[model samples]
Target chain A: MEGFLNQLPIGLSIGAVLLLIALGLTFTFGQMGVINMAHGEFIMAGAYTAFLLQDWAGRSAVLVALPVAFVVAGLMGLLLERSVVRFFYGRPLDTLLLTWGVSLVLQQLARDLFGAPNVQVLSPEWLQGAVGPLPYNRLFIMVLAVGSVVAIWAYMNRSAQGRRMQAVMQNRQLAATSGINTGRVDQRTFFIGSGLAGIAGVGLTLIGPVGPTLGTYYIVDAFLVVVAGGLGQLRGAVIAAVALGLLNSYAEFWTNASLAKVIVFAVIIAFLQFRPQGLFVLRSRALT
Target chain B: MLSVDGLEAGYGRARVLFGVSLAVTEGQLVCVMGRNGVGKTTLLNTIMGVLPATGGTVTFEGRDVTRLKPHERVKLGMGYVPQGHETFPQLSVLGNLLVTLEASGNPQSALDDALEVFPRLKPLLKRRAGFLSGGQQQQLAIARALVTKPKLLILDEPTEGIQPSIILEIEEAIERLHASGIAVLLVEQYLDLALRLADRYVILDAGQVVHAGTAADLQGEEARRLLAV
Candidate 1:
């Protein structure tokens, strides 16, 4: 019972991190239906931004890095959308290949810049302590994850621009006829999606090393979360992230880590076979 | 308020409209009537810039708007309600109206004005539009467009697949819109409704406007003869 209780916080922490990473993937992959393999790199870029900032400014670097990484990653996403992803809308295979190539290019760029070495991000004294059984850093990430989800949910539900995105997601032709600049919506979606991933990168550094390939490992897991969640549904992403994160944590506690991943994939595949549309079914008249 | 001269447009290689020209004056209700697949919707789409014009020009309020995007045209006071009354199904009725209001840069006031115009929508503001009956959805769609306070409203087949009682309601709403002096370019298949509302008429046959005349000229045999595929 004590062992189980001890593992619970770590499971919850893992779930929170998964939620943060998958939030951005939900927008890019689930809502827009774009295959952004390079999303993981955005997370890496955020982490590297934090690393660089910490090297430049010691104690306050972590605080400053959060916003800076968001902008950096968001701008990168916007650039990718304009230069490449925009041209490949509705062509999933092309987007997949293009973003995969982008991932490789970003990986190479990071390796060249940072010399393939994993950098340590020294957490501030404020974040060094623990809350009961939970590490303060882990608790901080969990809070951020919840905060981000709330912020995104409120924006999507209340804001006019967010409603326009919902309209575009439902029907592009109808949205255009209704006077929404669909292109601008697409741009903003990319920025927000990538920006969230950048923030997730900050969370990632709390638990582990910040390295060039940090995003690559999480990218596949994030994709799994999106697929296991219902496409175009935010609630599904949250549910799926927590469920999968806990399941993976429990499985890894009992078995080998590699086998745990294989088990997770198996469970997701089996789950999908039963419920193809996923946990939440989006309601929209398919565009003609 | 709107003029299309020698407009040509198509979907990829399959040409759908050829040299279709018409005029809609201020506060006038101009109906484009045709049988199924005769490019009535295509003409509207071209005018709204959903489909690119392959040839000719579209003038809206004396400016050549042929090359403007669909959203830009809407910003310029041209409102379009496409075929099928494509409401955002997931959103509530109010959400649908708010979309256009937000896009038009007028939110709260536009909502109040739209609700005042279509008071039936006020009670159902919180209801998801997909669950609404076809009539209600159509009303929401039109109300969504009207929230923008567009100078010119273009509707394609507004009465399609709707119940007769609701159809009558839509017709009455059209009358009110006309009375308000908003220029309306309506594409409708219902002969009685078109004749009842339109001051001027254009008949399209196989992607071309075959006849253009006053509504009185299209009263009886000429209407059936031109409309018959």
Candidate 2:
């Protein structure tokens, strides 16, 4: 029981990070059907943004990097969407290959600017100690993750812009007929989705090192979370994130980390065979 | 209010509309009729700017809009309700209406005018649009377009796949719209609805305008001859 309680925070923090990353993937891959393999690079961009801010602001760098990372990553996403991704809208394979190439180029750029080795980011003085059983850094991450989910939920459900995004997500042609600037919507969606990934990258520095390959580390798991959760279903992404986090934490506790991952992937493969459309498949006349 | 002169459009190499020219004067309800796969939808799509015209000019209110994007045409008060009742299934009926309002740059205004026409949608505003019956969805689609305050409303098969009872409701709505002097371009499969609502008729056979006349003049034999599969 004591051990289980100890693992809870770690599991929850993992879930939070996964949720943060997966929410963006949910929009990019789930909603738009764009196979964005370069999503991790956006996350890396966020982490490096933090790294640069830490160099300048020292202890307050993480705080400053939050918004800046979003902009930096969002602009990168905007450029990617405009220059490359927009042309490959209906072609998933080409998008996959092109984005993969983009990711490689981004990775090389990062190595050139920063270095191949992982760099450490220092936690603020306030984050040094634990509050009860929870470390302040992990708690901060959990709060950021929860806040992201709430903010996204409200934006998607309450805002007029969100309604337009939903319309485009369901049926682009119908939305266009209704006078929606679907191209503009797609641009904004990609920006916001990439911005969220940047924020996720900001959260990532709390637990790990920042490096050229930082994005590559989480990219596969993020995709797994999105696939396990259903495409375009935010609720499904949340549920899948939590489930995967818990499963990984518990499995890792019992066995080796690599083996635990193998188990998680195996379980996901099995799960998909039964519920092919993921956990919360949206039913719509357009989809049919 | 709208005129197409020598308009040409198609899906890539296979041209679907060949020199299809017609006009909808102010306050006129023009019904376009044809059998399945006879370019009925392609024509509507081309007019709405959802599908680009490959050749010729579409003048709306005397301004050429042959090359305008779909949203731009919509901003110019050209409203469209597509073939399938394409409501945002996950959205509440109110949300669907709000989207139109957002596009038109006045999202906060009450949908009094729209709701007045489709009063049945007032109570069902909070319900997901996909959950509504096909008839209700059709009403919502029209209501959604109405919120944009369009000068010319284009409908593609408003009564398709709907039951007879609700068909009357839709027919009544169209009549009311006509009574209000809104220019309507209707693409319909039902001969009775078209005959009841249209002042003028244009029949297309294999993407060409084969017959054109007033509703009274274009009768049984002519319609069968033009609309035959």
Candidate 3:
């Protein structure tokens, strides 16, 4: 492969990871008009579930762990909605404060259970194998990321339930008046959101070890993408993810990875300053 | 048929609609007119179950619907085109229509009927509803409400933001719906337009019905003064 073309899959792979994570957060924060600071906790919850399962069973357990994480995170989201997030919805500052507090509590609880150190999971042998022509490259991770995007894209765009979800996301009032049970929609969307996070955590486990403090680090970065993508926009998640992924990769190629993230965060802030509505403003009527 | 009696509703503690009562027969066009802040919109919203009524009885086709959820009311043959025609802007005009069809038990909604009523929607079906002009959106909004083939159609200011000619088209569409035996309950600011099409008119002031009579009674000078801004 040509030099630039050879790097395309890597860029696309990073984009997929960003896309998956961003997609999950979009529903919790974007469509439902939530400021879920604990979204990363859901991701961590997924990772932890996978980690625990990996220790008990063989490597193929990671696949089973994916669904288990989805259920765990989704149940947590439902509980959060019923308990905490519902009260402060539409009050962004209060929600931010609440979720920030929740992140700490969740992290401390995880530390108590799993210890403060990182816990690793072995990738399955099937997923462990690579298909790219290069001996030095491990590109199966790239395929997994792209595959997730395609699956999510199909679910969100083609199915009746998916279309209804889009309806609720686009305009809650109109959708409700159209005889869609928006409360039901809200619950389902939140589940999908949290489940997506769980899946993303599984993806993260494929690349890196998960720690009790896992959620704390990625929460801010995901928030950056949500703000940059024009909150509530699914496509905006894709755009912002790709842009941030490419920018971060290229910046890291030149500068340090930590410095590149700072630049990306700074760029997101600047983007917000210019387009407060986000990159692609989804004309939404969130049930605030 | 539709009926609302002693419908008292509010936003928070501030009561908006006070003892508002009205009825609409099937196939009749009923218009609710009032000055701004008279709770005209609230009355419509209260009946549609968007805003819960503090005290009232709302019966649609002889069934009590006051306690039903907005979407439940919708499933029971109620279609609302709220003020500003709040359609999903991100979706296309086609999407706007398709979304409403979920309310109907019919496998496929009568799309041809909707397109026939609003020809402009045919070309604009592929276009995002928000990108269309205000008039076009208005037409699409009404057509969207009709897609479900509701027994009762409620429109809250269908003429607002629309041009005079398009307003006429909407009025004509209401007339056609009325002719088809669908009850139409409309709240409009334009007195002339309301009087022209309505079989009966109910005027609100401070959430109470200040006047209720035939459209012909509105032609007299006293009712004319009530509509004057």
Candidate 4:
């Protein structure tokens, strides 16, 4: 029990970053029906930005870099969607190849800019330490991750623009007929989704050293959370991430971290084999 | 209130509507009827600006709106309800109503006029549209158009998949909408309900108008021969 509790914070912090990464991926994957293999690169770009900014302006610059990362990543996503992604909205396999190429290009760009060596970033003084009732318990990074989940969920469900996006996600043609500007919705959704990923990258820099391939480490786990939750479901991402966090944490108590992934992957693969749609699908006609 | 003349449109290289022409007078109920693949829905889509007219002049309220966008047409007093009961599944019934109203330059608070057409939707406003039955969704869809308070209300296949009782309710709503001095352009297979409510009828076949006359003339053998009903 002590070992399990000891491992909880570590697993949860990683899962927190995973949740943010997956949230953005789910928007394009689940709603628009695209598998952007290069999405991890957006995270990498944001992490690199955070690293550079932390060095230039001090650790307190995270607050400023966080939003800047969102803009930079979102603009990259916006341009990508308007130019390349517009053609690949319905073509999943093509999207896979295109985004994969994009990811490679982004990683190379980061390597050239930040150098081959991994860069380190520190969280601000207040945001550096542990949170919650127990000392050395929950990580501050995990708290920001948890807060990001809440913020994203609220943005998706509460805001008028979010409703418009959800409306488009639910029924694109119907939304168009109802006078929703579907093109604008698509562009904005891509920006928001990618921007969240950028924020995830900045979050990653908080936990460890930032590098060009930092995004690659978390991409596989992000996909698992997104798929398990059923794509585009904001709440599903958080729930799945938290549950997977606990599962991985407990497993890592006895099993090695690498074996823990095998266990999680096997379970997720088995899950999808049974429920092809996902654990919490919104598109199913269960209501009507 | 709407005039479409010499309209030619199609899916791609193949032409479906061969210079079709039609008119809906002020405050009159006009129904367009045709067999499957007869360009009934296509004409509506072109009229609503969802489908661009390949060659045609669409003038609404004396404005040449052939080039206007779909949302722009809605602003010029044109409301469209597609053949299927299409509504945003994620949005609540109220949200659907508000979205339509917002587009039409109104809001949910100004829905007294729409409520008169579909009082049933008032109670179920909070429910997600995905949860509604086919009939309820249809009612909500029509109400969405009504909230626009358009000069011309265009509904394609408004009665399909609806129960008999609900069809009757829709018929009553249409009659009321017409009586309130709003123009109605309807497409339907329920010939009896259509003929009873609509003042004029146009039968189309293979993308051309086969017959056009008052609905009162539906009694003759020509009606059956032309409609294939």
Indicate which candidate wins on lDDT: 2
Model 2 per-residue lDDT tens digits across residues A136-159: 999998898889889988988889
Off by over 4 Å in 2: A284-288, B107-110
For candidate 2, lDDT tens digit of each residue in B66-150?
A: 9888888888888899987778898999999988888888545536788999999999999998888888999999998888888
The most accurate candidate by TM-score is: 2
**Model 3 per-residue lDDT tens digits across residues B1-229:** 7989999999999999889899998778899998888898888888988888899899998999999999889878888888985777777788777767754554563766878989878988888877777788888888877787788999999989778888888888888888888888988888878877899999888888888899889888888788788
| Cα-based TM-score, every candidate | 0.96, 0.96, 0.89, 0.90
The lowest-lDDT stretch of 10 consecutive residues in candidate 2 chain A is A279-288
Tell me how far the alpha carbon of residue A51 in candidate 4 is from the true structure, in angstroms, after superposition.
1.5
Instruction: Please give the lDDT score at residue A137 for candidate 2.
Output: 91
The positional error of residue A168 in candidate 1, measured at the CA in angstroms, is 1.9
Q: Name the docking class for model 4.
A: acceptable
The A-chain TM-scores of all the candidates are: 0.96, 0.97, 0.86, 0.91
Tens-place lDDT digits, model 1, residues B1-229: 8999999999999999989989999999999998989898889999999999999999999999999999999999998988887789889998999888988897588778777767888899999888887778888889888887899999998999999988998898888988999999999998889989999999999899988889998886877998876
Clashes of 1: 0
Stretches off by above 4 angstroms in model 3 are A1-15, A55-57, A126-138, A246-261, A283-288
